[model samples]
Target: MDKSLEKSLTLWLKQQQTVCAGYLKLTVLFGILTGLCLLAQAYTLASVLDGLIMQQLSLLTFYPELIALLSLTIFRALLAYAKESSGFIAGKKLRAQVRQTVLNKLISLGPSFINTKPAGTWANIVLEQIEDLHDFYAKYLPAMMLAGFIPLIILAAIVPINWLSAMILLVTAPLIPLFMVLVGMGAAEANRKNFSALQQLNGHFLDSLRGLRTLILFHRQQAEIDKIANVSNDVKQRTMSVLSLAFLSSAVLEFFAAISIAILAVYFGFSFLGHLEWGSFSLLPPTEHRLSLFSGLFVLLLAPEFYQPLKDLGTHYHAKAKAIGAAESLVTLLNIQDSSLTSHITTSLIASSKASHTKIDLKTWELEANNLKVFTHDGECLLGPISFTISGQQKLAVVGASGSGKTTLVNLLLGFLPYEGSLKIQGIEFNQLDLSHWRNNLAWLGQEPQLFHGTLMDNLRLGNQTLSTEKAWELLAKANIDDFVSQHPLGLKLSIGEQAAGISVGQAQRIALARALSRDANVFILDEPTASLDSASADAITQSLTKETTAKCLLIVTHKLSQLGAMDTILVLEKGQLNSSGSYDELMAQNGLFCQLNAQTAYDIDLQTSLGLNS
Candidate 1:
């Protein structure tokens, strides 16, 4: 990772601490209290040993000191427990807030933006990547501060007794963190590669599972399995490499701490034998030069405690690296700007609109577009600078060849794509109206029907839970699926699997249509509604849709010429531009793109009939 990027991620991680700042402070407080207790325990133990060995005191005479020592031990344990609990709470609150932030960002970007990435890649980011931040907040962050404060506290306690030992500890303290950083740089890079490999594996494995039937039909299941295996093995190797670095960091910390303590032990032994008497000083007797057992023992007892915090910091340094790797992906996703969405709507505008209870009359609603165009993120125009008009009860049909901007126009009207020119509804600019309110007044059905695992009533009432059973049945009847649903033993309660596993595609499409009708929307947009149905099913659906949408504005995109005869207007598009627009009979008489499309549709139908493929 670049140094600047790593610094930025570290800064970002620190900013999130504000959410649980109180808990983090409590954790640090408990840790400081625990360190203080350690110093008192060491002092008491050293005094008791000095009294017994030097002053020839009886062990039974020290009952109060012994009891005090035991009580301090129990109190320190409780403080340690509180510290752990506080850190855990901090981590839990931060993780929940970050996860919700990510979810809200994804929702705001909309489905068109989300569908560009694989489902498994998003799943990994939302689930596994967020989970990796737990330890950084819980352990590593608190330990970072404690590592500095606790060691200084120990040094403060020792400087009066033995300045040489204090200097020795202070000199070796920098080595542990210096080596930790050296090993951690590689560990962080390895973790980043590991996360990338895991994301790829997840996407590939899920895609294969979704298309398992197609793979089997094509006899490529074995090839897919081998590819998955190779990806999984790569992830394993990267994981092992990260662990190796983590262990090496721990080893380095321990080695430096051991060597520092050994040097202290050798100096204290020489002082006891009168070889280094200048380093030891007694405050009560200025003339005394001999080293006392109390000072030597106290410094030795506090030696391990001095290095404990640094060692713990080295151990948790890996967590910091792991969190940085995870944050790289999360920050990138949250930084994406959905330029197509109008986000500058003022709060006061929404407030005033709601206060006045503003509403538009559906019967007089009109949509007009002038020189409208759509461009990709890279500034490539995908749709035209064409013009059109739609009023209440108008039935318009958009017919064009593949990649002729049919879908792009529908997406623009649906508010999924940004436009360059004017698009107004009821004389109001489209971007000025509240998007949620505008969407509620429109109904849309795509080429593929989406149905969850539920009953007929559940699917139909998805948009309006308060819809009565009779009203649901009326919707199903309008979509011409009441008979099929009523024939099932469960009637409205009939069970279905995901994507309507127990029913045919035509039946699922009808249920989806009924669901859309339940919304009671003013405008209906259908894209290839009967594209996969047989002749009987297609005709039934077409007749029912035509009857139901007679009183509302309808925009249908289709290639079937049979459904075009009754349309009020037909738009013929050639390569992202509108070639012509007129009534069905008028376009047919023009002998242009519309006529050519009609001839091509008829020829394909005749060809299918001759090959017996239509059966």
Candidate 2:
């Protein structure tokens, strides 16, 4: 990782600590208490040994010290448990906060931006990548703090007993973290590659599953399987590389700690044998400078405890690297600025500007567009500087060839895309209105109706949960699917599996239409609602839509020119510009794009009939 980027990620991670700071503080407190208990336990054990050897005391005479040691041992265990529990709580809260933040950002970006990436890519980031951050909060952060504080606590107790042993510990302590950082630098890079590979695998696997039917129809399933296997293998290799680096880091820390402890043990052994004694705190003469067994035993007992924190820190260093790797994707997504949806004006101002606020009267609503153009993030125009007007209770159809920006125009109206020039709703600038409020006044249906896994009643009442069962039947009747739903064994209780698994596509579209009508929106926008339906189903939907939207403004984007003849006004688009705008009969009379589109539609129908595909 680059130095600056690493620093930024570290800062970002530290900032998130504020969300669960109390729990984290408790973790560190319990850890410090555990360290104190270790110091007390070592002292009591050292005193007992000194009394038995130097004072020639019996085991019965040291009952108090033995009992104190036992009590300290149990207290240390309890403190350790509390530390872990606090860390777990802190990690859980932080993950939830971060996950909600990511979800909110995705929602604000809207479908226009979200559709740019595969569904699995977003799911991977939101779930697996966020999960990888757990250990950093739960283990690494508290350990980092304790690694500094605990080692110092041990040194404080050891220094007075033997300065040389304390100096040895101080010298070796820096080495553990130094090598840990060196190993972690490589580990961080490996972890980053591993996360990237996992994201790719997730996205590819999900996309393959979604397109499995198409792949089988073309006899390409085997090739897709091979590709998936290759991606999975790559992820496995990268994951192993990360694990290898983590193990290497632990090995390095253990090697240095064992060497440091061995050196302390050798010093104590020599001092006990009267070979060297100046390092110990004894007041004997120069030639008879001898170390007491109590001091030597105390220093030796605290030796391993001194290096324990640093070793544990080295072990959890890999968690820091893993979290930094996961944070890369998270930060990138959260930092994305969807300039189109952002507005400096407050919602209150936007709402208060109109007397009726968000609740505009549906009967008198008017939409006007002048020189309207939609632009991509790069400022490239997707929809042109065209103009149109929709007045009270008007039915308009926008017809165009593929890539002619028909969907872009609808997206602009739905507030999913930003536009330049004048777009006004009831004389108010469209951009100045609160989007959430604006969306409430509009209902939309796309080519593929998104029916989730739920009962028919649950799906229908999505926009209006308080809707009565009687009102729901009325909506189904309006969409012309009441008979089909009523005939089912469960009626409104009928369960529609994910993506309408048990229902035909036409029936799903009708159910979606009923759900949309349940919103009682002032404006209705349908984009190819009947594109894949049979003639009978399509005609029924068209008739239901015409009847239901009679009192509301309707805009339909379609290629079937036959049903469009009844549209009050039709706008023909070629490329990104509007070729012409008139009634269907008026456009048919002219030798323009509309006539060519109508001729193409007729040809497609004849071709389908001859092939018996329409049956």
Q: Which candidate should be chosen as best, given lDDT against the real structure?
A: 2
Query: What would the per-residue lDDT of candidate 1 be over residues 484-585, giving only the tens digit for each residue?
Result: 988888999998897688898888888888888888788889888877666566677777777888889888998887677778988888888889999989
lDDT, model 2: 0.83
Find the candidate with the highest TM-score and give its number: 2
For every model shown, the clashing-pair count is 0, 0
**Candidate 1: pairs in clash:** none
Tens-digit lDDT track of model 2 for 1-615:
787988898789989989999999999999999999988888889789988988899999999888888889999999999999999999999999999999877665557667887888889899998988988999999999999899999988877667888898899889999999887776777888898998899889999987888999999999999999999999999988998898888889989989998998888788888788677555321234676777777777888888888888889889889999999988887765433223321211111223244435557978898888776533567888899999869999999999999988887777666567888878887767677777877889887789999999999888688989999999888777899988889999999998688998778988898888888787899998878766666777788788888878899999888887668999999899999999989998997889999999889978987888664
The TM-scores, one per candidate, come to 0.89, 0.91
User: What overall lDDT goes with each candidate model?
Assistant: 0.83, 0.83
Total residue pair clashes for candidate 1: 0
